[model samples]
Target: MSSILTNTSAMVALQTLKGINASLSSTQNEISTGKSVATAKDNSAVWAISKVMEADVNGFKAISNSLSLGESTVSVGRQASETVTDLLTDIKGKIVAAQESNVDRDKIQTDINALRDQITSVVGAAQFNGLNLIEGTDDVNVLSSLDRKNDGSVSASHITVSRQDLTSGAGTFGSTGLTAAAYGTVNGATASDFTSDAAGKVAEITFGVASLAANDTYEVSIDGTTLSYTAAGTETAADLASHFVGQINALGLEGISATDEGAGVINLVNTKGYETVAVTLNSTSDANLEITDLNGGGAPTDGDVGTIEQRASTIDFSTTAGVNEGDSFKVTAGGSSFNYIAGRGETMEDVAKGLKTAIDSNQPDGITTRVQQDATTGQWKLAVDDANGDGTSTTFSLAVSAGGTASGGLFGLDNIDVTTNEGAAAALDNIETMIQTSIDAAAQFGSVQGRIETQSTFISNLTDALKTGIGSMVDADMEEASAKLQALQVQQQLGVQSLSIANQAPQSILSLFR
Candidate 1:
């Protein structure tokens, strides 16, 4: 133990000092860099986790930028749509003034043309960074989220916005690959053979024997108009029928006439041309009046319509695939052509329903639609007819064609020449539709912008939360780091003095050897 060669005390002291120096260096690093785990050498697992979270935070920032860009682009489109709507409203006012026969329509026409040109300008200029949502049918995706899984997999999420096309361009069409019979395809002679437009279809409301009742009530509904009759002073069924018939005839409802066909049968004939005349009798009293089913011969069910007034034409749909997303069809009937466009990812059912809506809403006259599916063949059918039409017009025809551009435009509004009376009348309707289109576009863009804004805000908040989490894992605690630095410095100084003392022990051993 006292040998000069083996200085155990000095060696132990030197090792202790070396350990203290290493700790001091680590504490100093934490103070300077302000991070407890800046490198893997400090805390490998924690540093790696913090690095990953930092990467995600950066990714979220990039997503925020994308959302901001998308929001601005959509905002521009919304503003332009609003502008177009205002212009159309102004044009409508001019057309309303032109409706009077004494007004100078030519001057109104000039003003209308100016407004039309302004709408075109707005549509063409509504682009943002080469993206025009109001003129084309395309989708835009904005990056909104970055998801990191437990297994260390990353995936990107986006918000998809659809374009609202308000362009007033020519419509295109395509084949549904099927055909349907038009109204009056069957001979008009037989009532059963005709459709809802069975003009001569006899609608009879018959009565039973003279039943005694005071104030017994019964309601008769003909073509949606109801007539309620109450028997007074114990009147017979015949008297009630006659009284009701006389009351109906006195009112002189258009296209309807009543006559006593037989003993107690009040036969009703709708001479208003090819349309439906429906008659229903319901008893509100205790006595039930029997109603005969005269659908086949003189009267028809709603579907068993003849070539009568209020008839429905059969429109079958045998659609197929291989259709382009923008494919559409135009059906011309009764002076108006209906344009139907297919939407993205829509089935044939959706297309057919859309067509039914278009035809019913914007059709000539009071044409109504009754859509049903052929149960056996599993095919779709649309029945379109002017519910109050007269079959006298042999010029009526239904034709369908393709090769039209599907636009959100008011059909032919750009070509409105309101100088002429006919043109002025047409412009009035067209301008309203144009205004509606612009309003719809504005609404759509507004919805998409709102979604983008929400996503942007969420991403910002999420990014901040992630940064805080990463800081919790790797950020140096300044108070704790300061305490450790002072303690390590004191230990370093003590270790130096101890090493000096141990070396003096080695000197003592050297003296013994001398």
Candidate 2:
């Protein structure tokens, strides 16, 4: 069947070798590249998806950086607030000295002025990268994006760091008055134990004071009662004792009397069975002085006056002469009677703090008020805190106008003062409520910052996951591709070999004729 004209066997062998060579080359290419689909023609859909996911990952990296920046900004604001709190504490000491009569009131006033200036400087300088939350003029907004629905409805998340604007200005003070009020009770147990015998009563309240110079007057409010006395002659242990007993009986109360134990020590006896009543001392002196705690033990020392060993609710105004529009004041507020100050060098935001001090000072134990500012109007308004805690609370208007009134500063409400037309206690309550509002807002920023950080981290992780998924769907498998290419080359070679064999059959007919 073979003919010289056609070498079909050789042709088949040549085709087979070509096929094997092609298979080996394909396999070698797959091994060298390590990918089955190296181009878009291999798998277009998967490649597109992977590209999209990678873009998202890049975006997320940028978002993570933004979150870090936002966190730093908020941290700076928090530090400023903390610093202000410390300055307020130092100011409180100077105010207490104003109550003294013989201690050079002018000098004390000068010291107070200096301290106020220092506070202003601190607040003004407390800044980071041109952002200052305390000295006013700064608004911080942390940017974030959220996908609310599956349809790609995205919403922006914002965290605002309000400025504690302590700047002083005129006509900025808002009226803060209340509808209900309550007074604090001064417990007498700490002063001296009271005793009563057949002689009716003996008062045990002894005030340990530094040298009480001439022309000094002392006022004692016991169990919500007011008793006043003036030092007629030079201050001695005997005269102070006699005055204490006389004032005790003058109240027309039973079972309460006074006794002078020795040297500046006095003991109060409760002839009655009530243990809740106590004596409070308020000094009317022109000298820079201090008031010791009513229950303060031992003889009064040079530094003991106005020494706050324990806290009481009653507010003692260092500037008792009353304040004008510009004068600042300091007082205590809240359940713990946390001390704070208002007036001069204080911004509208800090004024809210003054309001809280006024409220807490009015009552030893009373309802706590919470305050808030209207963003549009900038007014600090008050409401009851934990309305269910004690006695029915009422709404009070601290703002001059309801809507569209320039009431509060960026920090909170400014120039706000509590009024007693509502009630003395209510006035104080309103003040406290305003301060709480500002504090609550500051807290809100902290929460927002935390949420932003969490979201940023989530987005970062989600982007990475998306990239991995996309890669799995589209990335080429080089080993599998190489094997398929080898198989295809073998099929092509076999076809050629079969065609060659068929051609040889025709040649076989020529051989038959021979």
Candidate 3:
């Protein structure tokens, strides 16, 4: 027990001093770096979670930038559309003035034409970086996404913002028949004067045309009312006069006349005057239809004149019958079959285009598409019309396929989708809707962007708080560590001194033994 190797006091004191030195160094590191877990060795769990959150924050920043770009593009388009609307309103005012007979009719007409031309110019020039929303050019997609709920329900933010061009300048009203008809004149005066009764009834005029010039003007009269119009160069007898009457009849105006060859009696329909009247006609060899009884009397009643009313545009869309997302619905029209997967991004446009191309291409079925925007429901519904080549225009509703979600919808806007089964017809309607939808969606995004920005700032601060929390749990207290280190150093020195004295005593015991 008295041997030098058995001096445990000194060994313990040296070990204690080494422990104090390690504590001092640790405290100094924490003080200098201000972080207890700067490395994985400090606290792996907190560091990992914080790193993941940081990555998310970075991703959010990138998304914010993308949203910003999309917002600006949509904003530009909305501004252009609004500006063009103002111009259209101004044109409407000019048209109203042109309706007034007391106004300088010719001057008003000229002004209207000029205003129309100006509107055209405005629509043509309303473009942002070469994208014209008013002139009916390109479409814009606002980048948006939808979120799915745990119950399998899906909701979404409009990721794609599309701008619709409504500038009537595209001149795409195609193939709607609107040509004039051939006229039959019996002859008697300048091509412009027509025979009429005292009540302004159109008199009978029949002419045998031996190849009239393309722009020749013909005037036929009954009593004295002259019915004058231009003739096409190709006008011939094979062409039925009734074919011409059909259109004019639809205009609520008297447009034709006839005579009984056997009775030498003339029957007429009047349009320019208040009451229908009749007059006698005397055929002259002047190559033009001539008439006498000039202004004596006899006008046709309203019953004698036919009326014409324009039917609504025939449009249709294609969709499956009562199918959900898991089910497949196939619509074959215009020679092609468009299939829809329930709950997927099956747009009315996609369905409409198939029918339009099919019908126009004459694929046995005269299929067309019409889409409607129900401003009341805010649902973009797809309706397919007339299953096959049948002349019936029927409508059926379609929704997102099962497992499919809706996105890019306008906030507070109802029925934004084209609801017609006819493609071109749907386009005409949607061209207006797509615009309003985008505007509403953009405004919604603006509100959301503001909210997200606020949340981002809050999240940033929360992250700092979390870091502070983890630091509180494990970080070294520098002031306390420093004080403890000093105390421990003093204790180690005293222990060393005590151990040395004890060793000396043991040596003295050995001297006594000697």
Candidate 4:
């Protein structure tokens, strides 16, 4: 145990010193690098996790940049749309002023044309980094987030913004597109006379005295309002008719009057201009009341009734075939042609409205256009009225063609002429529609811009949180590292002294040999 060759005491002190020196060096590295787990050799699991979080933070930073870019693009679009809306509103004011007969409409129209040109310029300039959201129908996506799964996989998330087209291009017509049959069909007479002073429609209802019974209930509904009369123990058909007429007159219905024609006959007259009143008669006993003549004479029936509609020609769009973009609908009247081409995602209602706008551009004298829809059939119709009411007949025809470019969203802005009486009326309606379209586009852009801004803020906060988390996982505790460094240095010095003392023992053994 005390042999000079072994020097066991010195060897043990040397090993202890080596361990102390290694700990001192490690503590010094922690102080210098400011990270306890900077490499795989130092807490590999924590280091890997921290590294991944750092990568995510970097990714989120890039996403924030992307969101900022997207937000700017949308902001440009929103501003442009809002500008267009304002311009359209100004044009509307001019159109309104032109409605007066004494005003100079040519000057008003010049002002409107200038405003429309400004709108076009605004739409053309509304772009950010070559991305124009208000000039096309395509949708753009912005990088919003990096979705990290529990399994350490990541996927990118995006916010999509749709484009709003505000250009005024009239679009080319296609020859092989929608056929005439597939587009729409004209219903009713093409040429018809309109008489505004014509008498209101007439109808008659007769009660059967043979089926009279005690307490029999008779109900009559006119234009959705129902009136009922219950008979006494003994009453003639004349008494019933008189009671019903008094009840109908007492209802104070506008433009409607009823009279007892004696002998169980009740005559109802409609005096409302440009509207028809519906009449229905029902009784508790099926054979008690009969509808004899309603507008036209026919065999008497329990509920048979007819009404004459307003004198207007209709173009009913085909419901069987779907409307495609670029489909053109043309209306020709009095040797003039009015055309409207469909835009993307438009329906037959849009087509009808567009055709109406086109026809109103010229504003023919005594002519008016209205868009109508059938509630039951879901079919859209454009009604052309020769409202002159001078008993003059007007002829109009409708035709559709396919396979051309779609028109801009503001299709009829170029043709908004308010020089004539009819033109002023049409311009007022068309301007309102164009203003609404621009307003809708602005609102859409505003919504998406807000979303992008929110995502950008969230990403910034998320990145900060990630950095804090990564620091907590891998960062060195500087106070603790400093204390440990001092303790390890003292231990290394003590071990070195102990090894020197132990080596002296070998010298003492040599003294024994002396």
Candidate 5:
């Protein structure tokens, strides 16, 4: 064991010093780089996880930038819409002033024109980085988040902002594609006058053939008054009709009279001026009775049984078929054409009001429009009237077409003339709609801008949390590294001294060999 050629002690001491030096180098590296797991070779699993989280933090930073951009764009739109709303309110004030006969109508009209031009300027200038939200009908998306799945897959999330069209473009009219009968109908042949006289309109209710059964109930409602007749196992249609006529006549309703014409026919006449009497029929059993409008020659129905008396020269739009986007309604009056194309989620009520706005934009002499809806029947009617009451008729016609581009949200702002008495009256009604459009646009933009701001804040906080988590996983503890560095240096120095002593033992063996 003490032989000079072996020197086993020196070999053991040299190995110990080599291990201490390696540990010291690692401790120095941890102090310099500030990461315990700088490479995959150091701690493979932890390094991989920290690297992935770091990448996500970078992505979240970019998403934060996108959110800031989107918020700016939406803020511009909101401000512009609010400004347009204020301008419209000012124009409404001018229209109210124009209603007075003593006021200077021409001066008021000029002021209104100036306010409308200002609205146009605001909408045109409401853009952020070449993106305008209030001038078109397209949507924009902003990147909000990067979602990582449990299985290491990632997907991006976005916040979508809907565009609000606030332009006043009249839009192009397409070729005739919609069926007139499908969308609406014009009831009166004459366009200007609704025949009003002391003698009222007549409607006939004819009962259809149906087999009566025991305990069957037949119900009829006239002007919200309900009357019912129940059969005791045996009754003829004529007997039921006679009973209804007597019951209706006993009510003594003013301006209405009913008489049994024949077997099962009852003639109901409405003598009321400018009002319609609603006649409804219902039966407990479907086979008990069937009623229909005999004058109109319509099929037998269950609910409404009599023909509706025409009270005004009306254009009635159908409510059964929903209004689709791009459906255009055009009104030609006084040799001028006015059109309104439907937008998304519009109804027939919107169509009627839109047509009214279109016609009022020109303010034709001797023509006025009124939009009315029957509460019971839900039918939307546009009543075109002679405003002067002089029986002077102007050329008027209404037609509908499909496949046309929709009009802008503020469609009739340009033609809002408040100079004449009729124009002032119509402008009062039309300005309210324009103001509402701007208000809705402003509200929507405000809501989305708030959401984007919240998301931006959340992303900022989330990024900080991720950085803290990554630091916890792979970052070096500076205090612990400092202590370890000093400990490893002392161990290296002690091992070097021990190796030197072992070499001295080898030299003593060399002396014994001498």
Candidate 6:
């Protein structure tokens, strides 16, 4: 029944060899390319996803570059600010030395001027790639990330750094820019506190009675309010005092308190206002009782009793009696200095009044001035009171120097011509402020630089993560591909031999015919 034309065995072998050859070729392609899905046709959905992630990785690399640039720029500004702070500290030392009466202040002032010029140079050169963060009031942005949302939307993340201005040129003075602290370490205007014991004298109302008798009555009057108390027969002087105390306590007068001292004496305290307090007393039953003004009808002579310390800051003009037409004196107080130059026909009184006027010219808030004259000693004093005090725990000092020069520059911190006492005093305070500003700028820049560095590192790590994800989707398993290549090669060889054997079966049919 087998015919030479229809050799089914050979046909089946040929088809099997063709299938094995095709699989072998595909395995070789995978080994060479190292990718299971090298083209969109291989895995359309996975390939598209990997492509999108690859684009993200590239974008993140660019952001890393931007962050590097931003970090470098901030570093430069931070270093410059630190250098300026150090220079300011050096100038402060020179100013402190000038405070000594024996030192040559003019020479120290020259050193101060040189240091100021160097600061100007440092500020001018503090830049990276022509971007100066400490010279202007603009903001710089650094690309930090590419945010991809779940809804298939994309946005960019940026780190914005603001600028700190360190310029000391035009518009930097006269209250327009770079103003110093107006009120430092001074008393503030406050609620007036009245104290009877503040004058260091005790006010006493006395009674001549050896003991209290029945139906004995005494009256106490304070700040225009009077309360009377009657004693029982068994009551002594102490009991009379206690009964009076109970009555005043019941009244609960505002800003005033009453206490009973022993031996028929009463002590009254005024805790309310700055007004002069008047205390009077009369007794209806004690014909022998006596009351007197302990302080001669005024505040207690010793200011150590329950008194609030008033404007106690005093600038004595006692040492200023050697009057000359051209002599000058300088006093530094309240973060500024007041210089007084003696003119013709000006006395120590005029000098004291002149300094008071100069201090008031600053127009500090809640500040009041008084020029007190000691008529007996002919001594004049300038007192400054801060109504609104600086704070509860604030304190300050004043620097007064005499024999000063008439023509020396003041502290713009550049014009610190310490040839005179006034210039040296002003520079001492101004330099402290300048140094603080520089330190603050350095601290701010350091924070920004740290942020940029952190963001840059995060972007680099995120880019690596994305690359690994893309690899997982598209990379070939080389170990599995190598095994498949050997297996497919063996299958192909066997298929070729089988095909040869099947073709020979067709020739056997021919031999049968022979």
On lDDT, the leading prediction is 5
lDDT of 6 at 1: 66
Better of 2 and 3 by lDDT: 2
Better of 5 and 6 by TM-score: 5
Candidate 2 weakest ten by summed lDDT: 189-198
> What is the C-alpha local distance difference test score of each model?
0.68, 0.47, 0.40, 0.79, 0.80, 0.63
Give me the runs in candidate 6 sitting further than 4 Å from their true place. 1-11, 172-419
Q: What's the lDDT for candidate 5?
A: 0.80
Query: Which residue ranges in model 4 land beyond 4 Å of their true spot?
Result: 174-176, 179-185, 189-305, 317-338, 362-367, 373-379, 386-404
**lDDT (10s digit) by residue, model 4, range 1-106:** 5787888889999999999998898889999999888898989899888888888898998998999899999999999999899899889889889989999988
How many pairs of residues collide in model 5? 0
- The TM-score that candidate 5 achieves is 0.76
TM-score of each: 0.69, 0.43, 0.40, 0.76, 0.76, 0.55
lDDT value for candidate 6?
Answer: 0.63
* Model 1 C-alpha RMSD to native: 7.5
The global Cα lDDT (0 to 1) of model 2 is 0.47
The better candidate by TM-score, 4 or 6, is 4
Candidate 3, residues 1-514, lDDT tens digits: the string is: 5665676766666676677667666666776776565666767886675565455445445555555655555555555555545544554454455444465645644554565466456556755566554333224554343344667565534444334434331111112121111101111111112211112333432344444466666443333444444657675422323322333344443533353332222334443322224433222222433333223233322322222111112223223223222233333332344433222233444333322322332322433344343356433223222323232322222222233222212111111112222322333333343345334434543554455445445545654665566567556677876776677667667766766765565566667666
Model 2, C-alpha of 368: deviation from truth (Å):
22
**Positional deviation of residue 179's Cα in model 4 after best superposition, in angstroms:** 6.2
Regarding lDDT, does 2 or 5 come out ahead? 5
Clashing pairs in 4: 174-403, 177-402, 178-402
Worst 10 residues of 5 by lDDT: 191-200
The full ranking of all candidates by TM-score, starting with the best, is 4, 5, 1, 6, 2, 3
RMSD of 4: 6.9
What is the full ranking by lDDT, best candidate first? 5, 4, 1, 6, 2, 3
lDDT tens digits, residues 1-514, model 1? Answer: 5766888888998999999999889888989999989999899999888988898888998999999999999999999989988988998899899989898888888888898888888889999899997877778888878887889888998888778776666455655432323211222223222333534345556665467477677777777777888777567777777877887788788878788765566777765533556676766564344433343454434321122233444455554443345557444444466666654543545444545545544545554455556668766655555444444223333343334445444445656666766556556655655677679779988998999999899999999999999999988999998999899899999999999998888666556557
Residue 93 lDDT, candidate 5, scale 0-100: 93
